[model samples]
Target chain A: AQSVTQLDSQVPVFEEAPVELRCNYSSSVSVYLFWYVQYPNQGLQLLLKYLSGSTLVESINGFEAEFNKSQTSFHLRKPSVHISDTAEYFCAVTLYNQGGKLIFGQGTELSVKP
Target chain B: DVKVTQSSRYLVKRTGEKVFLECVQDMDHENMFWYRQDPGLGLRLIYFSYDVKMKEKGDIPEGYSVSREKKERFSLILESASTNQTSMYLCASSLTGTLNTEAFFGQGTRLTVV
Candidate 1:
């Protein structure tokens, strides 16, 4: 069985400040990593994903995450954030041959203050 | 673009009643999923269907049933609705054989059991 752990339940930051959301996973085999975001009263949208080569993956909305094989971590980061970036972020993992079953973390609530 | 649509956005049901949540995808996806979302718990997979007439139980399948008679449609059923089942139900779909592909999600259905 594979599982994801998001250390932060809520993070409060001011506008233009940098933010980091920590995520760790436990799996015996190689797994694919993903980050997803959900706005208020809406379904989730994919932020980024790490499949194979590049250790670092980025999203168009100034969000990026790096996959660390040694530490079993895939942390999401943003250099600068706006008020519009306030949402719930989730880290997910799926094994290579698991038939597309994505296991998600508890989630992190990013609250950006103006 | 893939479009996943849920039957209802908001539903109010009485306790001990039978509840059915419908999901439909238009992109001819090979995978469909049903998940429940809470404030702290990001998203927990309840059931998934890989192909027509093929369904699989996920992490949390207790008290829940699913039907996938068609390729584009998946239905989640609550045998006896309870207050604990009052949460946001999300439907998602993804392509088959893609390791890094992101799943497209519907708007979600907020079910309130009173």
Candidate 2:
């Protein structure tokens, strides 16, 4: 069985400050990694993903994550965040087989204050 | 761009009532999923369908059922709604392949059981 663990439950940062949300996963075989974000009262949206090749994947909103195979971690980071970036972020992993099932981490709430 | 659409943005139902949550995807995706999001719990999979009439139970399928009579539509059903089942429900669809695939999510349905 695959599982995801988000180290931080909540992270508070000021506007324009850098932030990182830690995520770790446990899987026996090859897995696909993804980061999804949800704003207030909104559905989850894909932030970025690491399927193959590049270990570092980035989103258009300045958010990036590095897939460390040795550590089984894919931490999301942003050099600077805006108030609009305040949201709940979830890390997920799925196997490399068809009909793959996604296992998600306990989301980290990023609260950006002015 | 792939589009996943949930029938309701918000729903209120009484306890023991039968609730149906419909999801339709514009793309011809072979995989469809139902997930529930709760505070601190992230997203928990309720059910998934890889093809028409082929459903699989996810981690939290206790009080939920699903139907996939067509390729583009997936429906989640609550036989008897309970207060604990009140949460944000999300629908997602993805390609059948394991590699280079990403799930597209709907806007979600907020269900409140009173």
Candidate 3:
């Protein structure tokens, strides 16, 4: 069985500050990693994904994540976060051949204060 | 952009009522999923469909049933709603392939069973 672990349950950061949300997974097989964001009342949206090719994957909204195979980690980072970035983020994983059975972490609540 | 539309944004139902939650994806995705979102628990899969009339039980499918009469629409049903099932429900759609494609999600439906 595969599982995802998000290190932080909640992180409070000031506006324009750098932020890193740590995530680690336990899986013996190769897996695809994803970062999803859920706004106040919206559903979870894909922020970034690491399928193959580069170990680093980035979302257009200035968020990026790196896949560390040896460490079994895929941490999301942002150079500077805005107040609008305050939301709950989830880390998820799906096996290579499993289609889309995503196993998710407990989620991290990132609060950006202006 | 992939548009995954959930039928309802919020719903309040009495316990023991038959509840139906609907989802539709416009991207002709081969896979659609239903997940329950609770605080601290992240998202747990309830059911998923790979094709029309084909379904599979997910992590927590005990009290949920799904219907996929069409490729673009997936429905989640609760034969008898319970207070424990009162939480946010999410729907997602993804293409089926070996590359492990990313999923697109709807804006979520918040269901409260009293």
Residue B101, model 1, lDDT: 68
TM-score list, all predictions: 0.97, 0.97, 0.97
lDDT of candidate 3 over B1-114, digit per residue (tens):
899999999999999999999999999999999999999999999999999999999999998999999999999999999999999999999999877888888999999999
DockQ of each: 0.61, 0.64, 0.78
Residue pairs in candidate 3 whose N, alpha carbon or C atoms collide under 3 angstroms: none
| CAPRI quality band, candidate 1 | medium
True contacts kept of each: 0.47, 0.57, 0.73
Candidate 2 scores an fnat of 0.57
| DockQ-based class of model 3 | medium
Give one digit per residue, the lDDT tens place, for model 1 in B1-114.
788999999999999999999999999988899999988887899999989999989889999999999999999999999999999999999887745567889999999999
True contacts kept of 1: 0.47
Cα lDDT tens digits, model 3, A11-74, are 9999999999999999989899999999898888889999899999899999999999999999
What is the Cα-based lDDT of residue B72 in candidate 3?
Answer: 99
Look at candidate 1 and tell me the lDDT of residue B100.
52
